[model samples]
Target: MKTKITLNKYLLVSLLLPVLLFSCKKFGDVNIDPTKSSNLNPVNQLVFTQLRFAGDVTINERTSIIMTMPMVQQISGAYYNRYGSTYIKNKQYMSELWEIGYPNDVLNIADAVERTQSDPLKTNLNAMCRIMKVYIFARMTDLYGDIPYSEAGKAYATGIVHPKFDAQKDIYDDFFKELKEAGNSLNTSKDAVGQELFYHGDISKWKKFANSLRLRLAMRLVKVDPEKAKAEVQDAYNSGLFTDNTDICKVDYNNITNGYAEIRGNGVSVGINQYVDDGRPRVCNTLINEMKQTNDPRLQYIARAYWTNPDRLSDRLDVTDQVKAQVGLLGVDAGHYNYDNFLGAINIDYPGRGTISVPNGGQKAQLADFLVRSDAPFFHLTYAEVEFLLAEATVRWNLNLGGNAKTLYEKGLEAACTQLSLFPNGPVLTSTQIQNFKQDNQLAPGKELQTIDNQIWVALLMNAPEAYANWRRTGYPALIPAITAESTTTTIPRRFEYPLSEREQNAANIEKALTALGGKDDWTGRVWWDKK
Candidate 1:
């Protein structure tokens, strides 16, 4: 009877032990918490990450209006206090770009790097991150003369709260080295198993993109470091680049919601369609006049005339009448009356014949429908850019490119004109229209390089940062400075002022940086590469 009791007790313990073990076992749901883990594989996270990095037109309102678009005269709008582009806007306009880039690109990419490092399958993913790091940092340094590059995004690991500011030259050098190494390290066999939003894990396309970007950076250093630039160009050429428009680097926004949806910046806020919105920022004189002079059909495709009212758009107006009526606001701070007139100028801001009599209601030229369309793909890089750069490099530096400048220039024009149709739901420009534009706008023999850069600028519309950087690099198209700028006529901003937040929190580092920034963190300070 005692032996029987012992066996029964042992059986009860076994049953309870199995149940306890099962209860303690964790499911994936229990372990996989986004708040706790640094898993960078979530598709949604990648989608938003790309959006943040690529940026929407709405988010870039301040800088675009105050500096890039208006200064370049691609588009025009008013700064918060400044009426239209009449006066120079302060540094606050540039503050948001600096605020967003480091956190989104550097820190986020760093997180992705950490999560991807140990896994062999993520080789392509890791390499892509390295390339993206170059993209963001390049723009960052381009905007601000010096930024924290090498020591940035190391706060968590190395306790580097106040990272040392890296000179733009060092940053560019690092970009060259990193892109070269990272691009070469891309594994075609190993898929991008992480959050591969842009290419959807296609390593081949990623490789092409990497090489093309490297080429662009190489050309950026053409004036500053000729030998290095030549070598990089050759290397990039050897690596590969986008063969066609199909290979352009674009971030699709079709499936993702833009973060800027809640905060639509100041504007006209009305539109007839996705292609021609009644918004604050309208096509500037520089863009529209150029198109008009060339009789470019793309003008009608891009700009809309709000005449009569939103109601008149429904009337039987042909493309001819609409094109004739579509006019952008001049980039001058006219007096209150003139400003009122321009704002209320029929076909100016509000679509229907500038009938917005009230100062409160008049529209400045906002972006066209295609630009404001949420579903439009955010272009990162493109074959058109590559072709134009190649044309410039060959002509300007006499690089030993197999392709001639004329052919490359024409190809660039073709690519740029044809590819404008990428913005979905917008008018698809006809082939004949593109050919006519190309024929009518031939690159002049003496002004081939200038024309190339100008075309590049035109292609870079809405991509204000690149346009600004390229303008700094190659001062083409003879852009007029802000008419009422406090700055000297000879001076346009070479770099953006460092943010106020950096001034307060990272005071010491900022102080040290100001020394390199010529004892003043002013926009007049030229970056190392910007010898022009």
Candidate 2:
């Protein structure tokens, strides 16, 4: 029964055993004219490091819901925090893609690809690198609508410094194709590639990740291109996508050597601390009220309750602006109700709302802590998410997608709860706790998709970019306007505004994209996929 496909894909590295002992060494430096060409390992190292950052920081844990404005520390500016300013910053981040970022990060994969071609047996590494590049760029295009894709990552030799933006629909189609080809090409027999970063060189796991990523992309296109989405999902399912444990494609971050903390820690690179509210980003009233109403146990794990004063609760009306201030002066450091005790809380000078403290670090610290060793897996794609995806797809089958969304939704929720338990002394919701959540939050008739998606959103907290993107695709959770919320943009930011740097440097190409996308390049304009 072990066909060539299964054998080549799954058992190759496992069967090879000793032959899989691959290592990177610093060989002789090739000194060319003037400049000495150091070992290529350094470039490879940078390629790996940047991939981790691209996934963790940019697309995943953005503060879509509970974000602050004019955040403490001058550099603590995270535009994803509030409404108006957030929109402006998104515009800034968008424009820089072609001019600054595309050259810097996305193009590095081409280097990886070139390097891999030299080692005939190690060709799989080249494929994996290209696959990861496609993943990162897909996220970029999804967030910002059209972006420099086909022409991106080519500034070094091509002299085509100004890359034009590709439409979102086109980008998604390319991503889906790239993922399928990459998944097929991940032959474990050739040699395990990429320094065991995410799965310790486990090609099977990597393959699973490729398929799962395909599934996610397929799910994304459901609203716009249902037939294509259905075909892709079925293809992945028939091809045996990720069906094992959630730990298969987990990313790693050691506490000191390399991890989210190292990047977020105070150092010269990071010139300020944006972790206001005692190193914990304060919870938005919108999310807090909703969770409280649902009696969701995930609340305790996601965020900690600030020390409540008996006086403040009763005198809600009498409380002046001064009354609600940072509690560091009150000796609130580490406890169940303090900032330090919060699961992902950081450490720095704590400032209250509307107040900005300029610490000597970047907003890295203030941003929510990412998954790492002993905390949880840096989840690539989870079995639970797949189940939810199936739930949605099945419903689209005239309720024939062949599964109950409710049962699958609960399973996914339970899996998330189980995954959260990996954290030290993480909260454990009892059977009664689970029952209470289900009983109170059941979906009304004909609203199964909405209900499943809402739960998915909650499970994906701290995983904001996924939630945000999925929200756009499905429009679930039905987020209401925040109280006193000031957003000139639509209810949800359809896509990021193009980065300002692109406007000045890559004016010609930028203008081409603008013209292609009608007269304006505003964040409010919807992508082709989001068309009504």
**Best-performing candidate as measured by lDDT:** 1
What are the Cα lDDT values of the candidates? 0.62, 0.50
- Give the lDDT of residue 232 in candidate 2: 86
Model 2 C-alpha lDDT per residue in residues 28-69, reported as the tens digit of each score: 434421111223442243334343332323222232222211
**Residue-level lDDT for 434 in candidate 2:** 76
**Cα lDDT over the full model 1:** 0.62
The whole-model C-alpha lDDT of candidate 2 against the native structure comes to 0.50
Model 2 residue runs over 4 Å out of place are 1-39, 42-51, 54-80, 83-90, 93-100, 117-119, 254-273, 278-280, 307-377, 398-402, 430-432, 435-444, 483-487
Instruction: Determine which window of 10 residues in candidate 2 has minimal summed lDDT.
Output: 67-76
- Cα displacement (Å) at residue 273, model 2: 6.7
Put down candidate 1 lDDT per residue, 90-171, tens digits, no spaces: 6566776777556544666665666666777767777777777788778778888888888886675567889989877788
User: What is the TM-score of each predicted model, taking all chains together?
Assistant: 0.80, 0.71
Provide the clashing-pair count of each candidate structure: 22, 15
